[model samples]
Target: MSEDAIQAAARALSAGRLVILPTETVYGLAADAGNPEAVAAIFEAKGRPRFNPLIAHVATAAAAERLAVFDDAARALAQAFWPGPLTIVAPARADGGVCDLARAGLDSVAVRVPGHPVARAVLAAFAGPVVAPSANRSGRPSPTTFADALEETGPSAAAALDGGPCDVGVESTVVSVLDGRIALLRPGAVTRDQIEALVGPLPADQDGAGEGHRSPGRLTLHYAPEAPVRINAQGASDGEILLGFGPGVGDPRWTLSATGDLREAATNLFRLLREADREHPVGIAVSPVPMLELGEAINDRLRRAAGFVG
Candidate 1:
């Protein structure tokens, strides 16, 4: 949060070292997108597969334009949602300078202009594209606070910026605008309705695993905890930690939202999972979250956390 800290992180990044920077969604393990070795360190630190592409965080729309060819829909979405949690995937410009490793050697790149001031400041200070994925080991819950990030991957990073907890508490909604069509890649705080309002109805969700990796967050069994997770439970059995949604679950350890506000539940989702996993319970059972608005994103994360697929 300090100017000195930002400067130090900028310097480290300029020197091709990793820095854990906070975003509105989650803390990210950031490296120079143009530096292959620096970007490689992120994979090494998180144990992430090379085929999973990274999101390139930029300072402005112009910066993003420099990296990818924006179509009509992509431009409009960027104008409306840049500086927020909406990632746009577009064809990488032939001259786009992002490293091959960061893009997974694909012709497209997932890029965003984050809303978090600390993250924006770091991007501006570094003055280039930063490939930052969630700052946690692969298949683990993402860190929403500085303390959790430190516990997760701090030793591998040169420095970490403490910017408090993330406001969104989930990854950005990723939409790929390719070949004159818009496809929802991932859901987040930005609802499908919002994107549809601007770009018309979206095509079916893109299968990154089947088609190829054009964006991040496509792994089947990701964002998981050490404890087995069971979703849509009416109640938790003995020895299991209950994560309730609409309350009335009889003194649950963590309630996503006692009032049943999906937004509030989304904000608390990852932090609660991290907390519950720390207890080393027999298992974690969660109440059903409505399949609407932010709930879609919350459930997406929960499903992945439970390792239901892949």
Candidate 2:
């Protein structure tokens, strides 16, 4: 990481400007969590709704504790998965300086310590919590590379830190540890089985799905592409692009993983989606991915991308 780049990003963030920072999962459209105006810029830049909250990325577990009151379970999960892709949603500290706009005016706040070195350096340099959603336009595929991030959010941001491609290539696994019970809000690279081993069986749907937004990625139509999407497809329609997995019938425009490696497929998911969508196809058809491990996260994104309700 360049010191000049880090300093420039820190300066922009301190000046209440947006910065595109990379994480282990995906690049984020970052803003100072304590600044309401900065947080509002994120919403306006992405055309995102106010009801959807953003994840506050901190430098360390101690930093996260300052923003949210963690219970024993929350602490265990944090200790086991901090500086990683696990986002813990806990009760917000009443005195915590996170602005209401960043949390969508919710009593609870979603916090995480990113594992990316560049992100950590920027956070440490900024010396404050930074709330960042995926560095893309609202309802668009999350950018996995800094180049892609710059292409998506650059014009709207003050600067972007290039950290290459995201390793995990998916959002963090979000769990709400509030209300004394562990609820799985959104599945990502951190498998439910891994979380369950630590916190016991999680509730089926603990996320409050009503009016108020408890966490990000809860929106019905999100992570969408420009073209219409169709899932569980064995092949593509006449003018559609087929995004295939494993073996397939006709020639696919792109393949998530020809070898059927879920991890490889996960890494390629957004990149391939963005590629296929660039063609301006009539629609994008996706082959069925097994509902296991990283596949769950893939399917979750696919379902939302296709605008499926249930």
Candidate 3:
């Protein structure tokens, strides 16, 4: 990590200017969470809807507690999953600096302690909550690499830091620990099984219209590419590029994983989506990925990208 780059990003955030910061999952369009005008700049820059909230990144679990009211279950989850790709949504503290615009006018705030050293350093240097959404335009694929992220949001950003290609390559798994209950809000690198092992079984995804205020990724047609997408495709159609999974799929250039590894597939998901669009295929066909564990997050992204979420 370049100390100068980290300090520059932190200074940008402190001055209420938009900056791009890298995380394990994706690069983010970051702003000072306590500054409404700064947070509003993010909404304007991305053309993101006001209804969709943003996730506030903190330096540590202790920093997270200052923003949200956590119960025992929430604490347990945080102790086990913090410093990683998991966002805990809970009641907001009256003095928590996250502004109303950043919270999408909800009483709850979506907060996380990122594991990426760059993000962590910026948070500590900025010494406050920062709201960071994917560094891309609304309804587009999240950028996993610095070049792609800068291309999408660089013109709007005042400063940018490259933490290299994101290893996780998907957004954080969002779970609401509000009111002493744990409910799945959105799937990402962290799977449901991992959470269940720590805090007992979690219910199905609670990211519906009624519960949308509490999560950032509840949109119906998010992570979309310019070209239309076809899901569960065993093979490609005419003028379509196949993003394959298992063996015999043939197109290694676009293959997520020939050996059927879910982790590799997840890491490559958004990158391939971006590349396939660049190829200007009439449509993009996707190989069937099993809906289990990490696959749940992969399928969720594919469904939204295809604009056919249920």
The digit string of per-residue lDDT tens for model 2 on 181-235 reads 7877888999989999998987655353432257688677888999999999988
Model 3 residue 81 CA deviation in Å? 1.0
**Candidate-wise lDDT, in order:** 0.89, 0.89, 0.90
1 or 3, greater by lDDT = 3
lDDT of 3 by residue, 54-106 (tens): 99999988989999998998888899888999999999999998999999889
Better TM-score candidate (2, 3)? 3
Q: Write the per-residue lDDT of candidate 1 for residues 201-235, one digit (tens) a residue.
A: 87655553344368688688899989999999898
* Candidate 3 weakest ten by summed lDDT: 204-213
**Which residue pairs clash within candidate 2?**
none
> What are the root-mean-square deviations of the candidates from the true structure over C-alphas?
1.5, 1.6, 1.2
**Runs with alpha carbons beyond 4 Å of true place in candidate 1:** 208-212, 250-252
Question: By lDDT, who's the top model here?
Answer: 3
